[model samples]
Target: MSWSHLLGQRAALDYLRSAQKSGRAPHGYLFYGPAGVGKRTAAVALAQALLCHQPPEPGEACGACKSCRWIAARNGLLTNHPDLIPLLKNPETEKEKVLGDQEQIIPLDTVLDICARLSKSPMAGPKRVVVIPEAHRMCTGQAEAANAFLKTLEEPPPTSVVILTSSRPEALLETIVSRVQPVRFRRLSAEDIRAGLAQGNAKAQEDEIALAAALADGSLGRAKELLEGDLGRWRTAVMKALERAGPQACPGVGLALWALADAEGKRLFEEAEQKDDEPAADGEDEEGAEAEEEAAAKTESGWKRFVFRRLLDLCEVAFRDALVTAAGAGPDQLLQPDGAKLAQALAQRFGDEGCSRMLEALREAHFATRLYVRGDLVGRMLAGRMVSNLRRGP
Candidate 1:
């Protein structure tokens, strides 16, 4: 019952429970799965069980224990428990080692430091848990950082437990993968997402929860993000704008969407500023200020891309619905039944060929995102391509 809160991860829970009960828990565990599907949650839960003082069973932690409360007391990367270490390189904690999104390579020094700590005795309990989120990042630069950690992973201390979580296990080195116990976490179902949302967010309505679950593509994190950020309303507004635009609605609609995404991103940024609990670092010189400014710019760019991707997802679904409509499918068969009007118009104008071409254009735009292209330029280019494809057809 220690894992009662983890929805859609029964297999992983069962495996961990059995491992704990059998007293055969490995020194290292590789938690592999898609994003936002309770991998981190399970890591913390397992850590709690291992660190608990009075567990009813070997693998299960009492829900009301001191260790459980300490593990649950997490803020950002740091937890209240000293023995539970969450290794993630963020700008706030490790400014010198900050890799950001462009080159997120965990440096060799970080691994050495963790290995040194693990060599010592546990501070709080019998077991020391080290959770490394996005463990695949260590595989970058010809796996330089990964090779550094391989030594410790191969021969870990008896008191230490390393939990490596990665959505892309294929990116990890084979040597490292062979050492750890692999526990797979699959993507959550819609009902799982809905249930998770209902438990965490009390303000969410039934309709919003259902829609978020449907559109999240099995990502509980994204479902919560959609509802929390009200991106659904943003999508509704975009669909409404294209209602009576000129044939194709290319550059105009595209620019409008880019602007909307930008605005929403800024809104989220301000919300973060309001909730910014971390205090500013003192004695910042001119160079430090500039570096902070540069980091801020990168963060803003990330926000734009994130919101734009969500918008593109909605548009893609709408167009996909349009294709179904062109193929004589009714609204019931459409993925986005609420956007039936827009789908009907798009189907009537572009027919099947244009919609297919447009999806290709969307794919190009998505690829552009990966390349760190400006969101506005990508939007305009996508729209221009859509217009050309539509005109060529009819």
Candidate 2:
């Protein structure tokens, strides 16, 4: 595949392609971005172009070539190509694994492994490429590995290339960043995400795309995660729970606590982790490293946080709809889907002041959650207060 396949990050592709055509391709490069914006894909395309035996002009890989075939196959399976030595965390323990004394990531052991692979003559290809996903997972102690890799990056290996991908590049050593040319990827657009979902034949609605796009904040991967059946369900349930907890009785109650108590909720939490294909360093064996249970709990909490924020937005929209309806505004101006019924009911029961109070309760709950207050309890209390206030309108 060519670099054009990368959904966004046009400037990055142009720079890499220019380097290739000018025969000034750097030995080491970094592709950094939020997860799932096509950093890995771009790296693979570059690798394929570097190794393609019959490269059609400079910077373009003949996708039909043997080298391209291998790269494509590898991409399909998300495996490291022979020319590319991926710096990855130990899968078994799920933390950075140190191969040698140098605790730096892409430790000497891994770098040496790549060196050995590169030492061999090409098998019908001009160069060997090493692509490291989550390259920042390299341990600081593995500085020796980084140093070793740096030597190769600076000299020798006529046709060898190293590409590093990371969502958290700040975790990487400054030295490493300075040595390699950096390529940054931005989040995909909502339209791009919709096209991708369509291409994948995913079961997503227009509203679903809008919600996911809003929540994803640019990452197509995140948008896809939002489109997942579980997230959609969770979003719906959270919205209902918020509505149930209307202003006053206990306004905005601990809805997430109830939401997370189910088996499906736990399963959804686990699925969220699976979405990130990149693993952490072998920190599993390290002291004070995250425990599985603790990590799982954190993951679940993150899911709750995400769902809760959406609920807050839904509440505001519903309130806005109530206000608009109370003012005898057109349906098109309503924000909530049940705008007609809720608006009429709200106007009859609470009047405008009650609607204002309901908004205040939600705003307070949101602020409390952001301040690290107990989110579930705060949510429940907020819901109760909202419901009570709605019922006992001013």
Candidate 3:
């Protein structure tokens, strides 16, 4: 209901709470952290606390108030509130099937719209809360939009609060960042994650939960996505595919990797097109040419890259599990609790250094594919490197 609802990041919650209590709240606040660890949740909670009529804690929103109810009922902190300006991707319209916040990239038109909305007077509320989630997506062209918002931050509307949230804080302009108080949110613990799942009565295997938590690296949102099924399948599929492609005849490897790459590319494009909601027109025509170019500019490569990244991530988890074993840490300390024996075997075979080398090779292979290199060659090369390095005795 309050910032207390934000799992983990106790220090940040307390700091914001204390500032609210003291009435020393900054006009501009930045919440930066891994996605899905509740940065946006905390921001909204803080916004509600600021706007709440009868906040139990001086700065905390009472969650029971009309204002808080309205905020909570809204789809997103920025989207629903008249005062809250969300720079979220505009959904595809009947006329156009535009992307929705594609891979943390916010559209420029949305950025400008949010800026314009924030520049106006509050329609009904006492205070306006302007939020730009994925602020990093406010690209160079859109960064100009931040300038418009900056003046508001410098001299905010009476009782107005500006909240900026981003997973990639490094992409934000320094001037904009300097004007805000940064609150860092971290990943929730597996226990907290499990507790959250229990609240919803979600039926996910505990082992999968643990694995996703480890892969989340501190983002519960990411953990939730992994638990949703795609990431695990992607990881396992990539490993099996690579294993099959490697140590095969050159022609066979070519056929396998090409088929895999082309199939993945087509699937990604189709998913994107479906999301775009456009008719299946021939891509060679003038109208289709523009669509094709836009589609190409946006990577159909995301699917393959996602698979490769997940594979590399699995390898990293395996290494972390090996480290846990090597350090005499318990199975509970392992990222892959289900793979304890595999972790132990990996530890005996590769030790710490070799495990790192294997990960590096996998990453390099991903990079090579991105550069339009032959995927089969990269896969074979990476497989050879990992096998040579990891198959040796510690």
Candidate 4:
């Protein structure tokens, strides 16, 4: 729960500590960075320190204290602490929700509720801390939620601090941005991620962890997901499909990729269903069930996109490895070290130009996917292009 436990954010911690020591902690702070890079963790740690019954030093929270324990407690959607308010999107309306899915916008009602809470006196700690983990989702345009929240930011309570965290800070309102102090969180390096995974007791082997870190794009959250999820199995399947795909096998390869995507979508759907079946909290009603369905749909769509993107990344990495191998690169240069021999053989088959062309095709497919292109069509196009590219004369 201490800031020291947050790996790979030394600079951010230093700045926050200095601010605390100077007694100049801002009323509003924006912790902005990529997903899973410790923004929310840092915010929570800061809250604990601010509300700790006996803080040992500046920027340090006594985690064993009653106030800190309540803030850290997690029971369903709500935390045990009354003064520590977390404004997050609610997937189910029936529960006392604190956090939810990647919502499109923070509803106006939620913002008003937050304003009301801030108006009240502290229930336990010396100060109240409002943590908005995804503040960029605050409603814009005619909704007035962002505008409404501005009043609280403009004239914040004397004993309250608002902490806003977002991966997409550019999407936030200009006025809102101006009102808050910005704290930048950088992505963790591969070594940093590897160390963290080890510390977290990840079950993957060292090589597997290294591969995941390389593919994680500097996000610890992504690395952990890659380790715990089906990325390893899917990666193996992709390699096998590439090796088996001949000029006449484009349709078959495309079908295999389609199956993978379909299976992932179904898995996500089932998981959401299971979560829905969990009994609702005290105040939840029938309308909450309807919200759950909507949330499930959104989750499924997002999960599919993530799967497709990862598949595309695997394709890019494979082709890049092949290109490097064809140019007489060493094994250390390979992205997929676990499949080095396979990658080398594929490089011999495709040669330099073929690998380059395949990489370009994969890039185009990735762009198309981002533009909301149908996943099946993209898979088919990628399969056809890989076959055609590999079969062409040098």
Q: Which candidate leads the pack in lDDT?
A: 4
**What is the clash count of model 2?**
58
Score every model by TM-score: 0.84, 0.69, 0.73, 0.86
Worst 10 residues of 2 by lDDT: 284-293
Least well predicted 10-residue stretch by lDDT in candidate 3: 284-293
What candidate 4 gets wrong by more than 4 Å, as runs, is 75-78, 88-95, 275-304
* Number of backbone collisions per candidate: 0, 58, 2, 1
Quick one: ranking by lDDT, best first? 4, 1, 2, 3
Candidate 4 local Cα displacement, residue 385, angstroms: 2.1
Summarize candidate 2's per-residue lDDT along 236-313 as a digit string, tens digits: 565555445434423324555335433454566787578556674332111111111122234566555544554565
> What digit string (tens of lDDT, one per residue) describes model 1 on residues 1-394?
1377678888898999999888888999999877778776777678788888788889888766777766554412333366765443542466344333234566676666667767778887788888776678788765667887898898889999998877778999999999999999887899999898888679987877887788778877777667756765877876775664456456687888788889988887777676557763321111111121112353666667767776777777777888899999989888767878899998876778888887888778877886889988998897787677663434
Q: What is the lDDT of candidate 4?
A: 0.74
State the RMSD for candidate 1.
6.0
Report lDDT per candidate: 0.73, 0.62, 0.61, 0.74
Superior candidate under lDDT, 1 versus 2: 1
Q: Residues 1-394, candidate 3: write the lDDT tens digits.
A: 4566567778888898888777778888888876667776677777777777786767767777777787666523234455655554553342133223343455655555655566677776556677665666664456666676566667666556788877678888888888889988776777776665444425776656666666766656655545543555554554444334322332343244445555665676677668668654321111111111122354666545444444556666766677678778888777656667767776666667766776676568657767766655665676567556654431
Find the candidate with the highest TM-score and give its number.
Answer: 4
The residue pairs found clashing in candidate 4 are: 94-284
> Lowest-scoring 10 consecutive residues by lDDT in candidate 1?
284-293
Q: lDDT score, residue 18, model 2?
A: 94
